[model samples]
Structure formats: C-alpha cells, structure tokens
Target: MITVNAPYAVAVHEGNDFTANPPHTSIWGLLYAQVKQADGLDYRNILLNESEMKLKPKRKQDEIFSTFMQEAEERRAEDIRLNVRHPHKVDATAIMQDVMQQMTIEKHNDQSAFCVWSNKEVQEILELYGLPVDSSLSILCVEVFGQVNNTYEHIDDFAINKSSLIKNTEKEFGSEVALEYNRTIDVVGPQPPKRPIDPLNSHLGMHRILRTSPLTEVPFVCCTD
Candidate 1:
C-alpha cells in the first residue's frame, strides 16, 4: 500500500475517545516511509501485532485498561462488578463519561493531531474524493476488539449500536463538544473478514478542555508494533 511502503508514513489516531482515527479529508503530509516506519507495524499479524501487548500479556489488566479508555478502566469495571457504593458508582460513571466527553479532542490545526470515523473532514473526503476512510466506531472495534466483554455476542450488530453510543456521548457532553466525541470514535464492524489494513514495518494520546484535550499522547508505544 502507499502508506506502508512510504519513507516514513504512519497512521495515528488524533483523539482519545474510543473510535478516534484519521479523517479522510485532511491532507496528511507524512510520506509513505514515515507512515510505514511509524504506524506501519500496527496491524501486520494479528497474533503478533498490537493486540499481543494489549491482550495476551495480561488479558485482564489489558481489558480493564482499555474498557474505559484506560487508566480508570480497571476500577470502573470492578466497581460495576461489585456493585459497591451503587449511588456513588453511578455518579462516578456519569462524571467519568462527562469527563471523557470533555476530554475528546479534534483535529484541525497542525500541532500533530488524530482522525476518526464520521468526522466532517472524513465525510467531506468521502463525498468529495471517494476514499475509504474508517469511522471512529469501526476503528475502535478493530483495534480494541477484545477489550469489550461481549463483542462476539453481537459483533455483527456494532454498526447499528454504534450510532446509539454516538448519540449518548453527544448528549452526555452537550453540543459544543459533541462533535469531538463523534469525530474521535470509529465504528469498525459488520464483522467483515479481517484483511490487512496496513502492511508490515509500521506503527502508530490525551488531554482535557474537550477542546484542550491532546489525542496523540500515547501512554506506551510497544516496540513490536
């Protein structure tokens, strides 16, 4: 592919939300090499790729880390399981969701941002250029497949359900920031056959303000991917 073989091309998600990915419309300046060297190794071999670090090493820990957007995922999952402090837990979840909504970022400037599904930018590309760019919900399903508890039970139903998540997230954050949440999460599903999105030798963040949040701040970048 053009991106994988380029001198230094890399695919990076511009936001911190679940479906965040690159928009189709923004002109990416990175060369194929950079994308290949940087974001290339990401989806090479399913068993040996990003999922290896995110799942096999410590499945449970990884699950907790990813389920709620990391950092707070574990505690949130535990809280849900135990049903301890029900009122407080519910309140905390609301607060957390709100915080995350406020934390989702958008890609407009050149400070090095990310892209996602359904962004105005992507829709523009699809409408204007006819490129196939993934939506945030789809991308999230692709990258974090194992993180969700019942993905298999209804993996086929994600696209339909994803719209619901988008609406809920938008309502949670209010209008001013809803766009960012909508832009960050990609809904990758319909459970299509897994094909190589990007080729070998590649690679691939956060903040607050909803507007002020930084999406490229990756906690850990594995050497393998």
Candidate 2:
C-alpha cells in the first residue's frame, strides 16, 4: 500500500482525468460512494462536521453577530420614532387646565408668581406621553397662551405667564371654566400685587422719546426698534 499526503491525495482524487473515457467517474466520487455504501455514512457530512469544528475559532472572531445586533438596535430605534405621538396632537388645553388646577393649590411668593409652567416641566410632560421633547413644545405653549413676551418668557428658563394662561383658558374653554377658575383663585386668596411699571423702563417709551425729541433729527424710528 502507498501512503499519500493529505494535499496530494486531494489533488489526485479531485483533478480532471484526461485519459479516462467519456463516462469517467472521479476517484473522490468513487471513494465517497464506497464509504456511504459500507457504513451508511456520507463523506460530505463527515468533512462538513470537521470543517465546522475547525472554523469555530474563526466564527468567534467574526463581526457578523455584532453587525446583526447593531442592525437590530437601529430597527428598534426606527420603530420607536414611527410609533411616537405627534406633538400637535398633544392635549395642550387639558395640560394647561391641569397646570391651572395645580397652581390654585400651590403658592408662588417670588417674581415667578406669574409663571404657570416652566420649559423643563413641559418637556417632562411631553416625555411622559412618549412624544419628542423640543423647542416646538415651547411654541405650542405660546400658541395655547395666545401671545409671546406677555404670556411666555425665555430668560435663563422658559416660563408661561399666569395672567396670559387665565385669559387663554377663558378664550379656549368658554365662560364656565373661567368662572370656576376665578372662584378657585378667590379661595386661594389674592396673589401678591405686581410691582408698579415705569413707562420709561420700556423700549417703546425710549423709542417715543427718540422720535419726538426736539434734539433728534431722525423723524422715523424703524418699526423693528
């Protein structure tokens, strides 16, 4: 019997048999058929099992699993985005009503007494409902109150004005809610009186003085001013 190295054995068995007849069978095919017939086992299955076992190390190093995990995470994020509620659909009226009710029970002794809601508080409410938290929500607060600067102020923090909130609540929900809200306020007792305003403290007052003053040559102040 001759001993053939594994590489040479494979080359000799699998290589083309140019000298064979038209119906020629390969050496590897004959060996596989003999093994199957004798032991009821496929050489292909045996080789495949061995190959898989050898490749176990390589499989551990592969990025395919990590790639699949990343794809799964991305799909989950997309699903969340698609399923989240729209910002406009949020019940601003109801939220404002709730805020009003809460304000009735709470005391505000500081300058923020007029503030009915903060930007941070609104963000938390939106997040609780699975809605996107953004500056658009601040705009929605302004829309609910019917005015900006007078109703909403964004200094270091966004704040909604209590007076504007009351006026808008009356406008949106009609007289009954407004009357009830007024009664609630009466029970809570009067808020501290607002400080008196100096007309000269405002930009409009400054602009008026600039436009009408005899010393000034410019007759028109830009509307933007």
Candidate 3:
C-alpha cells in the first residue's frame, strides 16, 4: 500500500478473478505498504481520465460497483462449486455478515472495512521491493483489482483459455453448437489501444498492484533485552 510517494508516479496494477473475496488483504495491502516505505507517492485515486476524484460523491457509486463485484464473486463461486468439490472454504457471505454484526456501534454506523495481514506477507513484499527482510514500517496505500469477468465479446464465459475453452466446450457443448455462436477469439496483431492515454480505464480501481510501506516501526520496542 504505497501512499502518494512518487515524483512522476508509477502505476501499481493489482487484479484477480472474482473468487478472492471477501477481498484478500494481501494483494492491495502489500503494494501500498511497500510503496509507502519508498517515500513520496502521491495519487488522486477517484479522479483522472477527465473524472473527478471526488470521494464523497463516489462513495455511493463505489457501493454500487462493489455490489456488482460481490455478486460476480458469488456467482463465480457457485459456478466453481458446480464443477469441482468445494474445499470447505470459509463462507464469505456468512463471514461478512457476521463481521458486520460484530462491528462496534460507532463502526457499524460509519461502515468501515477491516484489513488483516500476517508476518509472511510483509516479508514477501519486502523481497519484491529488493529490501532485506526486517519487518518494521507503516504508512502505505492499498489498491485492489477483482477480475470477476471479462468484456471480450467472442470468448465464452466458461471457456477462458482459448484452446482449452474451444476444445472442451466443443466436446461437451458440441462444436456445431459452439460454432453457431461464432465464439472464436480473433488474435490479431496488437491493435493500438482504443484510447492511448487511459486504455482500459487504467486509472480506475485495480490497475496497479499496490506499492506500499512496511507495516511496522523502524526502531523496535522489544521490552526484555
């Protein structure tokens, strides 16, 4: 989770499929923590590409978007369960609901989110940043990207990988039927991005993995010497 710390600024791209919810703190949290440690990272999160980074107004908008993401995640889980035996993963819905209930009265009113991380995570981020692992720092920014689905018109939702998707669907769903829909992904030479400046609305959420600072103090406070 990098704070606003860079001179020119570098994009921290962080994204994943729908499954890793109720959000994995590791992804975004790590980035911010490392970046913050590096120092001078400034960013206008809610604004850019001619959009205003107005937090208050977008709170509701974020809720709407977040709800869609939640649904996509749930639907994805359901689809996965339909395919393979569930590994007894924690019930995200139940956990979220329970977490909401357990929040303090003031917190409940304010609607805050909780993020928890562990030692190993901090070490991993340190390694990424080319730092010797010594867990101690804080003051980071967190960015998250959840890729629940894609917008590719041709690729079937079920068949994500082109070759495997086509072959498998053809075997189960039938080639003739699949062909009827024209689901072939045309891999043309890299086309110039639709818009050069902000292709894929990269400015929006989840573009960059978070560059964050360590989540500990530089000098230790171990009591017993």
lDDT of 3 by residue, 109-139 (tens): 3212324434565456567766656434543
C-alpha lDDT of residue 31 in model 2: 8
Ranking by TM-score: 3, 1, 2
Ranked by lDDT, the better of candidates 1 and 3 is 3
Residue-level lDDT of model 2, residues 73-158, one tens digit each, is: 56667767788553223344544554554444332211110113334544455466444543121110000011122211211111
Which segments of candidate 2 are over 4 A away from where they belong?
1-160, 191-225
The per-model lDDT (C-alpha) reads 0.32, 0.30, 0.39
- Which is the leading candidate under TM-score? 3
lDDT tens digits by residue: candidate 1, 1-225: 111110112335675333222211111112110012246665321111111111112124334334545435556678778886752233445555555544343122222323222245434544453333331211111221212234323333455666776688778887666667556444432354533322112422211111111122112222321
Give the candidate number with the greatest lDDT: 3
Candidates in order: C-alpha RMSD to true structure = 20.4, 41.9, 18.0
